[model samples]
Target: DTAVSQTPKYLVTQMGNDKSIKCEQNLGHDTMYWYKQDSKKFLKIMFSYNNKELIINETVPNRFSPKSPDKAHLNLHINSLELGDSAVYFCASSQLPKRLLAGSYNEQFFGPGTRLTVL
Candidate 1:
């Protein structure tokens, strides 16, 4: 079984259309993250949920939102998708330190990724 999985491996949509990417993890991790990889392959974190609580929300547009129904699931919803939204969205999970101190690292399990194409 995949430790992290995302639905709709490829998504092709027109501009201004709304879309959502569902992600789930079977690793029972305490934290889940949403990342966007641009055409340049620069991965940037958009949002993170720790134990179902929102944390580490980057300076993403309000059109993007992440909802976590539970610790094992985190879904990314984009409203009024724009051409710039065309990128690979990844879902990752990890068991993190409760206090989030410096120099602490945990291996994150990443999903296959959902490629969003806006035309």
Candidate 2:
């Protein structure tokens, strides 16, 4: 039973093509996140949803969007992908404590990332 799972673990597409990655979590967590890891292995949060409501949206390109139909799922869609869009996308879920301070970190369960390659 994978706590967090993503579809199409590997994606190779040409530049300017659009793509979407699906994510699901069976951990029953109220919060889910989409993170992008670049070639340098720097991870940045793209979006976060808590109880199906957008909470944290980072300053990613407008071409990226996150959709969450329910608390247990989050999908990322990228339009007009470019060469710089090539990276490993990760889906993570965590049960946040009631009072999360500015620097608080919750224990997150991450899915096997989807590696996207834009040629």
Candidate 3:
């Protein structure tokens, strides 16, 4: 089984449209997360769900919403897509309070990522 999966590795859309990216993990984890990486390679945490509960919101725009159908899947829905939203969205999962401590890498793993392009 796939540890993590995200659909539409590449997404191209026009401005003002709605699009959704899906993610899933079979690792039996209670926490799942979404990260956005800009063209400059700046990684930022978007949303995190712990057992279907919204746990973290990193001041992301309202256009971006995250949904966890169950403990195994978390999907992202972008409303009114904008050029600014054209970035790589990655799905990840880990244990609760997951952190990459000093010199220590944790269990969190990322999906191949969905690259969004707005024109």
Candidate 4:
């Protein structure tokens, strides 16, 4: 079974339209994240939720919103989608990172992603 999954693997819409993507994880993790990959394949984190609390990336525009109805699920909504918003949106999940003397790292498992194309 897939640890993480996303709906509507593909999304095509015109500019100015709104869209939403849903995600779920069965890994029983407490932290979930949303990431966007541009045409150039540069991945950047858009939002994160820990135990259902929002932590928006400061650089992300207000047009992007992430809502977590529960710890196991996270949904992303985009208002007034633009051509620039065309990209693959990935949902990921990970447990809280633990501090260690060497450092701390949280391994994130990513979903198949939803490809959004704005005409």
lDDT of each: 0.94, 0.92, 0.90, 0.91
TM-score of each: 0.95, 0.92, 0.90, 0.92
* Candidate with the larger lDDT of 1 and 4: 1
Per-residue lDDT of 30-92 in model 3, one digit per residue for the tens? 899999999999989999998898989999989888998898899999999988999999999
Tens-digit lDDT string for candidate 4 (1-119): 99999998999999999999999999999889999999899999999898898765658888998899999999999999989999999999988742223454678999999999999
Number of the top-ranking candidate, with lDDT as the measure: 1
Clashing pairs in 2: none
RMSD to the native, candidate 3?
3.0
Q: How accurate is candidate 2 locally (lDDT)?
A: 0.92
Q: Give the CA lDDT, 0 to 100, for residue 86 in model 1.
A: 97
Sort by lDDT, best first: what order?
A: 1, 2, 4, 3
User: What is the Cα-based lDDT of residue 39 in candidate 3?
Assistant: 95
Q: Judged by TM-score relative to the true structure, which candidate is superior, 2 or 3? A: 2
Against the true structure, candidate 3 has what lDDT? 0.90
